[model samples]
Target: MQATGSSHSLALRRGDFTTLIEALDYAAKGDTGVNFYNARGELYATSTYADLQVEVVALARRLLGLGLEPGARVGLVAETSPHFVRFFWACQYAGLVPVPLPATMHIGGHAGYVAQLRGLIENCGAAVAMAPVEWMSFLEEATTGLTLSFVGTPEDFDRLTPSTATLPTVAPDSIAYLQYTSGSTRFPRGVVIDHTTVLANINDMASHGLKMTEQDRFGSWLPFYHDMGLVAFIMMPMATQRSVDFLGTQDFAMRPRKWLEMMSGNRTTITSGPPFGYDLAAMRVRPSDAEQWDLSALRVACVGAEMINPEPLKRFAEALAPSGFKSTAFLPCYGMAECSLGISFAGLDEELQIDYVDAEQMQEDSIATPLDPEEAQKSKRRVARYVDCGALLPTFEIAIRDEHGNDLPERQAGVIHLRGPSVMSHYFQEEAITRECLSEDGWLDTGDIGYLANGRLFVTGRRKDMIIIHGRNIWPEDLEYLAKTQPGVNYTDAAAFSVPSDVDQQETAVLVVQCRERDEIKRARLVKTIASLVRSEFGIDVVVELVPTRTLPRTSSGKLARARARLDYLGRRQAAKMQHQPEPANSLPMDEAMPQVRYIA
Candidate 1:
């Protein structure tokens, strides 16, 4: 199948418009738009700018006919399909706020998924909710008791009559969409972004971050519910009138090789995914397939969404080297939903840069003291490596602040604060949360621990996920990484956090590992090996528990929800204690007793 471009090419327009409607209107005059592919790398559908304009306008009229007021929230279950794209733009043209809800449902997580959708529907006070035909039942079940104006499939919404009423005029400051945080689905907060705010971010990302050009073609398997997927792949490409190719998130998960195959065939210039995506693809690559395709056209493989693990990326770059893939193409970036997608990006055409700092000093004094190469090689000190996330984007200000809200000096780890035009105005309808995160002076507390050295931002860990033990700071990721290095431990199969210490009131590290071995002896041995590895690596005693595969919870975007896992573990421990039952030694069920063994050095 052909790539996403029309026969008649038009000159590229790089952020010349103010609003999304205006941007689409200008893009319709050209030929570039969006294209979709299946798991087998076959094209399913293509929507040009001209085709979108016609359908969006027609759908907008029908949506306004529903008698919903301007600025009303329209909840759209964000499936990776053309319907979501149409409905999203329809809301923009009709002056309504579109709330993209997560469409991914985990196995045995139907009830939790329904509850999450219901909470978002109630929280946004959505006037209407629309899902694809396959997901209509879940949406209906989610809104059973809610007072929504309408709830059905996109086909149902399309069957509405057109209204003669004039559409409301959209302003720059008007709400573009409500982006819910990927963290904490139980209490999701919708970030309020205006047309101008998103446009500013898109402009900066396209012009400065990716350095977009007419020849640049975007491709991805990122879900539309995510800010990186929605803003970077969908909105940014449309704003620049550049063609983009999409593979369904599930399809990519099942067949990651198809993503690279399509990119190679289409000569895709830019694509982005979390580090896990690259790691999975690297694991599936064969030596013979290297000669089957060319990947030299891939200039920017933007990596974000979760912790930036350099090992997997290095493996991917090495495996694809014969196919002309450059390791320097990996653009490590730092961003959140609150910032409209991007905060800082690594320099273009540069290899990944990592700073090796004294780990003990960083944990105790919060000082990121860089280690000399010779000293790092000879010294017996523990060192932590943090990826350089590059400089902040132009027009953005980043300050590393202490607990007292004072700015910290360079090389000192502190809370990351941001001030920029693209920052969200507030959390929709959540005044208390909005006030807690955003200051009156327009600075936002990012809730991430990081240090700035020579203008580069180095993310250390999450503020809430930090573990303090014996006046020492331990990042969960550090422990998790060590656990994953053990034999039989897979990437993302382990979660590390702190629970109440059995000997003292201090917090103790706990590592929950998912094991496929059902044999009690083997599972117990695996747990022991992991505990030993953690103790040897970090010099800390840990409680290791093995659970059935896929027992650990993940966020909608597939990020390990460590905080939630800790809570679930504690709840199960409490329930088991109250039941007076013997703890299972191997393959413990999530709802049952959690068998814990503390390994003391």
Candidate 2:
């Protein structure tokens, strides 16, 4: 049966159920379900809620026959497919905790991927692991020395006989799933969430955050492993009984326009992605094709998962304006896996609100002093623009704290601490690390630097990513943004950080930019232009180096790996010094460099 049409037009609102199991049981009574699409916008697999419930119940019984106890960890390689979905719900029904492993494998980093998988399997102490037939080889290699009860493909899992034993009783406080943080797979921390926590988040996001209605339908290409994808798109839609359309991440990367086309065709109302995804679609969409599609039904296009760049949102809105797209549909949100998914969301049907601040004051004084538009235009002063990510959700509170644990007043930048029912219980099995971030008072240090202005949160940058240069705090994103505005640099093509200067052994800002120019003279000119731009804008002299395109490494979620890039820079510098060879002063050619190499000065 196709995954479309509601069997009954019952309009069930949020907060009608308290747990995901309860929500899914209510949803299965309807005909609404999920639809998967290919790169060319063709439907491949469809499953209704009723169909999924039947499969999940049967699979849960079979899994119980494996002689595993309740609360056992089941690691599932998260690819966007029917198998992953079936196995996830089966774990839920069997009272087992499901852990979604990332499906990404770096091109030449096979060993690294294996190590990452092994670390996660060991960390979660998973009793069983499963992957698709195509990924069985990787799983086999990763489980070399592990003591897993079973490690195989979905087909192998299906061969097991069902047990007549009764399923374990699951409560609201029972463990739901383990969601690992996106970056640094070598040292992964699983966010321990329960049915109560996740359901609370979903209810808030549906009722207060998105104001989701029965008419809303979800669509996305985000990978199922990411919290925003798994919780927001998959779990949230299922809870609300909303039919959703899915496109694989690889397919979306290959043909970005297909995302818009699917949304237009499916009349998807609620969808979301990071800023880079919108930017990519904006670049690929042609103005002439706008009239051929309809997007007026799209009400909320949520943006989060990374730093929100307004320029790209503007570009996307303007490019799709002819298709009846409104810029007001853009909803900038603040969230992390620790909070289950959402912390705050912008008001619906409102235009994006940006706070322009004095850059020098913000960096030097830890204050986000607003700049008047007329004064900003008259005086050629540096300004940093941050999007207002709305107020805290219901039953949530935020505190901005300084390094000494003193709470700062509004408009003062500091570490963002959040307290709510949605926050994770703890980092799985890492008590010391959990204590470092989570306080006994039930507050979670978000590790993000931001300020509150009239109750709205304006995220400045990451607290750990702040570069200290001559006692002045500099956010790397500011330097990267300045570099992107220069000719030939894309949004994610620049990574900025601070390294110890060879001459003075003091911290100095270094901007590593990726350029497409092949000619040596033009490449040098691009470097000069970027250096001059930074010096003029921020009044700091930065060591600027230009490398070939795609030289910078990115995290699995597509954000620049600033910390990794810094380590890479230090390693390359140490290697060059050990060889008694002077570092290349200007452009670094990718052909002669290591895979992890980027422009270093």
Candidate 3:
């Protein structure tokens, strides 16, 4: 299959349309469209915008034949294939709200994945659902007990007779899709983003975030379920009449180098991923491989979806530097699904910026004071490093507020709140949660803790993840950092949180590090070393536990789920006591007293 050209002769638009249907109508005039690639960096499928419009409209007619009501929900298993793209756009033409379910199934976790799918399907109240052949069994099982008008795969839907009825007129206020957040979730809620809200965010992203031009093409391996994948790669490119190359998320995970290959081969100017993607790709790339590729055309390599770790990004840039991957192309951004994906972005053609704050003052007073360079050189232990996520778009109004809801000044770390056209009006059918997260006026409590420094946003951590010990604020990321610094430890291997203490009105800090060492002596040494570092750094004793790798739970989008970790820890602790069995050696302090260190191997 031949991929679409990067440069097209048709006029380009910058996501200025109010509805997705309108945007698609305009883009159908252009030759630029989405291209899909297989695991080996080979193009497998290509659909020009004009062809995509015809396919989706035909699919929409068949979907209308199902006799479902307008504004009905259609569940879709979001595999990174042409089927998913066709179905997503078909819903837009049919005037039905599409909800993209996760395509990933964790190793040896079938029951868990099914339950998660069931919860999402139930929550969304989907009237019809579709999945690819490989994922059909899971979708069938998930919807077994539910009442739905129709359920099938793309092939099955195609067999349905096309309706003679005309397609309904989609309003700007109509819901485009329900993006289920892949953040911390016992059960995830769908973020309801209307056509106007999503398009506004896309406009802000193109006009300000990436400064998209007609010359810019896109490439990504982020899954369709992810906001970055859906909006940035899917919507943004088509809105501007730019072609995009897509590598499946699972395929990219199996062959990380293929992502870099796709970028170089396509001469794509923009791509984005979390820090882990860079880390994985850098680990797999060779200097010789970089020397072979022509990557000078690639400019914006956006990083977001998780906290930006400068070290991994630095390594990625260095590894690909031989291929003309400039360090200035690394763009750190801050966004969430609730806000339609993109709040702030670093300056174009700027190097990644870091703000080293005094860790002590940040913990005690919640202030992000820049550390003195001379003092930092003398004793760097007091510094906390955070990447600058840059300025918010002109559309957003941000405020930093304390626990009491009093707005704080710049440089003061507090809950980050935002109000903008991009912000979602509510969670799907979750009015109680919507009320808790959003105010009556407009502001949405983002549940993130950060500070604005000189108009730039520096995200510290999540508000709910904060631990208070001896009336001093404790950030779990700091404790995790101490563990990550240890040898044989990598990023995403440590989880830190506070457990309820035996003492009155106090909590004990705990750090769980995923250790790979099998030797008893080495494991013990690693735990003790991490525990001692916590003592010296925070003046608080922490119980350090070492567990097997991949034991730490993460959200679907690859963010560490610390709250779930704590719950699992407490559950195991209770189970041990009930079985009348002793806990792991040094799993707890010698006594219930304070300032006592314990190490678990």
Candidate 4:
């Protein structure tokens, strides 16, 4: 199948419409649309914006014919296919809130996937649920104990009769979608986003973050369930009337090269992912492949979702330099689902900037004192680096507050607070959790610890994941980075947190490294080597534990689930306490497994 053309006859728009249906109406007037690439980097499906508009409206009529309420929730298994895109827009036209459930599946972890799906199904109180043909059995299994009006595939939904009733009027205040957080728990919290909120974010992003042009076409392997994927690639492109290309998230993981191939062959100008995605792509790309790929038109490589790592980005640029990839195209951005996707984004076409600061003063006094890299090397004090996440959108109001909620001055590290049009008002059916983060006067406690310098946001660490010992705060990313520097340790292999030890009730920092080595001696040495490095670097003793590869749990969006890992550590210790009782000869080991990674917990 031929993909959509890069240039369209229709005039370009920058997310100026009031609702998604309105935006789709405008985009459908153009020839630009979305293209889906298979695992082999070949285009398999193509849908022009006009075709999408006509098809979804019909699907909307069919859905409304089911006699479901206007505001009924539709649980959709997002698998990066045309079906998901169709169903998502159909719900929008039908005035139904489409909840994109994760299509991610762990190898041989069916039970966990079922539990997660069941929890989400019940959490959102879905009126209807649909899955792809290949995933139908799992969906049936997950919905076994739940009650829903309908549970079937897209074809099944299509088999229904069309309604004679007119579709509901699309409103700006109406719920557009329910975006679920990739939490560490079985039940993920859904962030409620309306038409106004989402459009405001999209407008700001297109005008500022991307600085999109008519020639710009987007490409990504990010899952549809992810904010960056759903908002940036799909919605942003459609809203701006630009064509976009997509490769499955699983396809990219298995063959990261396909993403590059598609981008180069299609001349995609915009794409994004977390740091690990770039690292994975760099690892998989060979020198010969780079020579054959022509990526001269590729631009705007946005990075966020976690701490920015310059090393992998640099490697990716260097490897693809022959293919015409420029390092300055890397735009470091910061955002969350709570903000409708974008909060702050770096300047377009600019190099990703880093700020080096005195780690000691910052950790102790909550002050971000600037320090030169050379001075840091000479001085005995530790140094920390934070990427410049650019300035907040013009529509946002930002503040930095200390632990006691007192306002902090510039460069003072504290909890970042924001009030913006796109900020989510509440979590679906989660009032208490909503109040914990969002305040009364419209300010949202982002739960991210960061400081502002010259109006730009530089995120340090997550407030909830901050490791404190003896009144000193430590960024877990710092410890994890150090552990990853060791030999045989790949990126995302280390998870660091504070835990209570056997000797004392107070918390001590622990770094859990996923070691693939089976030899006890090598494993011990790897553990000890990291332990010594941490002690010398921070002047504090840090416990190091080596677990099997893939032991660390990851969120659905492919982020390391540190929160879940911490719970596993606690559960393992609790199990060890019970194991302290006299045991049999062939009993299993305590340190070998984790909670949902399922043994020690």
Highest TM-score, which number?
2
Instruction: For residues 370-449, write the lDDT of model 3, one tens digit per residue.
Output: 98666886985488889999999999999999999999999999899999999998999989999998999899999999
Candidate 1 lDDT by residue in tens digits, 191-280: 999999999988888888888888888989999998988999889888888888899999999988998998988888899988888989
Give the whole-model CA lDDT for all candidates, comma-separated.
0.86, 0.85, 0.88, 0.87
Where model 4 places Cα greater than 4 Å from the true spot, the runs are 185-187, 581-601
Once all C-alphas are superposed, what RMSD does model 3 give against the true structure?
Answer: 3.7
Show where candidate 2 strays beyond 4 Å: 585-601
lDDT of 2: 0.85
Across residues 1-601, which tens digit of lDDT does each residue of candidate 2 receive?
A: 3557533576775745666777778888888888999888898998888889899989999898898988999999998888888899999889999999988865237887887788899999999999998777888999998898888898988999989988777899999999998654237689999999999999899999999877889999998888998998889988889888899888998899999998998888988988889999999999888878899989999999446889989999999999988999999999999999999988999999999999889989988989986698789767888999998898799999999989999999999999999999999999998999999989999989999999998888887689888788888988999889877788878898998888898888888877776666777677777788877877778887665566576766667778877776677678777978755554445453533223332
Residue 492's C-alpha lDDT in candidate 3? Answer: 75
**How many clashes (backbone atoms < 3 Å, residues ≥3 apart in a chain or on different chains) does model 3 have?**
0
Compose the digit string of candidate 4's lDDT tens values, residues 156-212.
999999999989998899999999988764467899999999999999999987888
Error of model 2, residue 437, in angstroms: 1.0
Local distance difference test, candidate 3: 0.88
Per-model TM-score versus the true fold: 0.96, 0.96, 0.96, 0.96
